[model samples]
Target chain A: MTTMVLSGNEACVEGALRSGVRFFAGYPITPSSEIAEEMARRLPALGGKFIQMEDELASMAAVVGASLAGLKAMTATSGPGFSLMQENIGMAVMLEAPCVVVNVQRAGPSTGWATWPAQGDVMAARWGTHGDHPAIVLTPWSVKESFELTVRAVNLAERLRTPVILLSDAIIGRLREKVDLPPSVPVVDRPRPAMAPDHYRPYAGGPDGVPPMADFGTGYRWYATTTTHNERGYPVGVDAAAAEGLLKRLHSKIHDHQDEVVLTEGRWLEDSEVVVVAYGSVARSALAAVKQARSRGLKAGLLRLVTLWPFPSQLISQVAQRIRGLLVAEMNMGQMVEKVREASCGASEVWSVARFNGQYLMPEQILDKLEEVRRAWR
Target chain B: MALMRNRDMVERYFRRGALPTTWCPGCGLGTATGAMVRAIDQLGLDADKVVIVTGIGCSGQVYTLLNFDGFHGTHGRALAAATGIKFANPELTVIAPMGDGDCAAIGGNHFIQAARRNMDITAIIMANQAYGMTGGQYSPLTPMGSFTSTSPYGHIEPPFDMCALAIAAGATYVARGTVYHTQELVRLIARGIAHRGFSVIEVLAPCPVQFGRRNAMATPVDMFRQLQRATVSVREAELHPEAIGGRAVRGVLREVEGPEFTAEYEALIRRAKGDTHG
Candidate 1:
């Protein structure tokens, strides 16, 4: 292992290259521009392709197309660009193309703050695309986890045959930290079709619910459509049964395997009265606040979410059942608090600690919320 | 003998049990699709090595009927997707078929930039004047004062000359043909696919149900006759300028050699790899 001080965005580039991503297509956007810049500089030297597309829509489309052509591809953008990418991201889901979309989030409802951090896109990453589809979203709080989770994101996307979103905030994206980089990390590639070209059905999944993909020029000759398609990869216009089966399989491919897809980290949860639920950059503040509260004779702990989507509901429920109150802290205006409340099933009082004014949720602020929740419990 | 040869070509290139296309009875997109398939067959291209990327429209359904691997993507993004396909595997032939709205209006930026970069792909713009799949809506290619579902007051916007836009955007090969000129359209498409850089072949396909019924031409034959009378070949126009009054010019508008995107990128990769002789 070698020690280097790198920002979250730089670490993500290293992780993507380590994960065997050979194609990078993107448009420049703030906070996420470093990822694209690093890719532009690093990819060509490694004999990979890097393209600066006309817009985010083209970037997303190109990434999906490259993935289908048998290359691990990615694109990075901010909120405005991520919103533009939603339609093609939906296309990626429908086509079952494996690619990674890194959204280094900045404040928005339309460019609210260009250079500041906010976790407002948590909900959009899950439901920005139209239709009922499965989503795998990974969040990282530290620079080290940024590299680790990006590798995980690429692996999960390839294994499940879906577009994975690495949702990072501005603070985490620009924050610098010294991390030990491994010489090599495990890489997973999309399963190639083992069946003969004549017998292969492109969308026919095996026991794992993931169909082996064939490259375009490899003689499989199977077509892929964004429209609802049958196992033969032909459009199933208004065929309710085929549509239902395809949609359900798309969902269950990731949902049924949540045990491997969902990941989280817990602190002081063995004997704690108040547990703070947090993710992304706000989790750093929550962890610090939990430690401070424990030192001050308060029974407090932190439940840091590494996988934001598939919501970690089971783990949240288990933690909620054992705690007196759950403090959900985030850099947004009460997005995941609702999910925490639902998962807790009224077993614990859920309090939302939000900060959406283009600033980090400081550890001191989270400590105040923890104190408030503790007093209310009494 | 001609009918037998055409039947053999269809059997060889078309997908089994995939025809009876979804196009309307009198749609000109069928003719355009036939011309494209014939061009591919004439060029002796391998079916397994070709990938057809299409956008959302009545014209986009052309890929579904072909035996080659295909991607039926969302509206107005076929060229962008095709660009990726070509870049990822330069050995594969990427053909993108898009409608007027899909090519010139919503996907205009991608079209221009693809040409500007001189990406190696063939783009067949089926310029049916209006959006036929969404009923009859005015598009950027819809002629001025043409009535449609969206433009009941007669479209005030001037239609874009797609061939000129492509030439100005630095396409290495550009051509235009009407669906009425089936043999010429096939030849143009074949040449476009053979070009080393970006090629745009705009086919003036008639949307009889949507574009013709609103205009004076109510029948498919009337629309075909109108196209035959309104367009002149580039050689004919040059020979007799008086014969080309306000008629649209057909045939190759631009063909020139320039650096192709993928080849240049490969050289850049070699240079980045510290190979001095690349």
Candidate 2:
């Protein structure tokens, strides 16, 4: 009943365990390696399993395989390895197999900075894999949230019967913070089809956008493919009908349930003129920036995203209409700023401050950007 | 031929029904498949407790024919997927089968790593020496000078010796055979399945329309006979690898190991938990 202080990395593994993640297969990469190491040590005695795969592709592929075999599975990797995993991530989505992936982002393009903090993967996690498909990504700014979000990632994966990505980064991954857990938390179980084999077609949708899953040995006969598919999970050739069907499901599955997927922590946002929009470490710095702005007699609020994908576009649009000038602070060359700009449109002047080197956005850096935007507007 | 599971008490439960596969005339996937079925049977693993995983290529379709659990994943990742499945439920017997191209070329990294770590599973590599499903492209295991769609002028790269790689990479059990020699192949597969660590049975299947057309064995049967002739048993392989040309080291090459990855990982968890409280 006693709560222990844990690092963000430690919380990730704890979250996975609490969520009933019995299988973790991954290859050790910088920033993300701690999650894999922790999982490797913990899964076995829990009546689970851990594997250090050959590479990121294999690590990603293994978790998807385990998910299909009726186990909650996960893998962790940083930016470079995450890129390698995109190919298989697409397959998991197409097959509608539920699995969790932890992407503890590092500096990128190549293995830019192996042991440094950077949030360059925010946009890459969105459109990294080929083709038009939907993704669920969560962000955790501290150790407690890392654990909580990792559990939520697994739950979302089961609820949606699709891959749910926990978007973490080097700063949050390595940062030591006090972690607290709820007295009680429920893990979402993946929905299993109750119909007999004859009545089963794996891809048939339930009332929710998710389809019921039938594990490999459960006497269910269903086809799963990356190609456009019909209700039976059989491949439909890529044509007008096929493309339309595939896109419709992809969009509807996530869009219709955006409220469940997108999460943001609103702090001092309701009555502020300028709102600092950020996620991950940028949000941490923005907190400091907002404090500095308020100390300087400026009305600055912080809107921190806990979920990156599904973008929380409606929320951004709503805030954009009220806020005077929005400041987007990030660690990439304007990756997340695009989302803010798109959502804000002409309602607010979207100001972006970003960097690509393996470094967190400093508090002063964000404050400077906010001042520049405010002066230009004034 | 459909299985007579009832007569043999084989508990006919591979999948929903029998297969009328779509392989070409005189293809050896059927024989390899039969060998797998018999191996699983011979092991007497609970049919309900088996999971067969496959990746893209001709062999990917094999999962559909089996009654046990099956995961047909993306190209070149059957082993990767099987590792995950094994970790999820260490009680289940997981098997991975992939074509030469799927395992060696596209999935080469996973294969070597799986063997190196020696995860508990049976991997049957159906080495037809060409990419069969994608209409005959050059594969990693395809012998140099073998003609394929991509290698019309003759494959320029040397072929990978799959069995040699498996043995070197620390597979607890390793064997080489061919569809040409079904009885021996099935026996090796069964032994591999029962070996309790990473086991690899490389089946030298004939790709008649693709590989055999240029590696140009006189016939599919003759191609198999070559396996019968080319291989030396483990004893002989240890003695004189050169005598049999050394490509087909056709018996158990190695069978010693530490505890497998999953069990060790589990033990670690037990230790971690014990330290926590009790």
Per-prediction interface RMSD in Å? 0.7, 2.7
lDDT tens digits by residue: candidate 2, A11-119: 9999889888887878888888888888766666676777777788888888887888788988888888889999999989888888888888877778788888778
What is the C-alpha DockQ of each candidate? 0.85, 0.44
Residues B184-227, candidate 2, lDDT per residue (tens digit)? 77788888898889998888787777667666574777666666
Judged by lDDT, which candidate is best? 1
Cα lDDT tens digits for candidate 1, A1-378: 999999999999999999999999999999899999999899999889999999999999999999999999999999999999999999999999999999999988897799999999999999999999899999999999999999998999899999999999899999999999999998999999988999999998889899999999989888899878999998888899999999989999999899989999999998899899999999988999999999999999899889989899888898888888899998888999999999999998889899989988999999998888777767
Chain B: TM-scores of all predictions: 0.97, 0.89
Clashing pairs in 2: A44-B266, B13-B67, B14-B66, B14-B67, B15-B66, B15-B67
The local distance difference test score of each candidate is 0.92, 0.80
lDDT of 1 at A54: 97
Worst 10 residues of 1 chain A by lDDT: A369-378
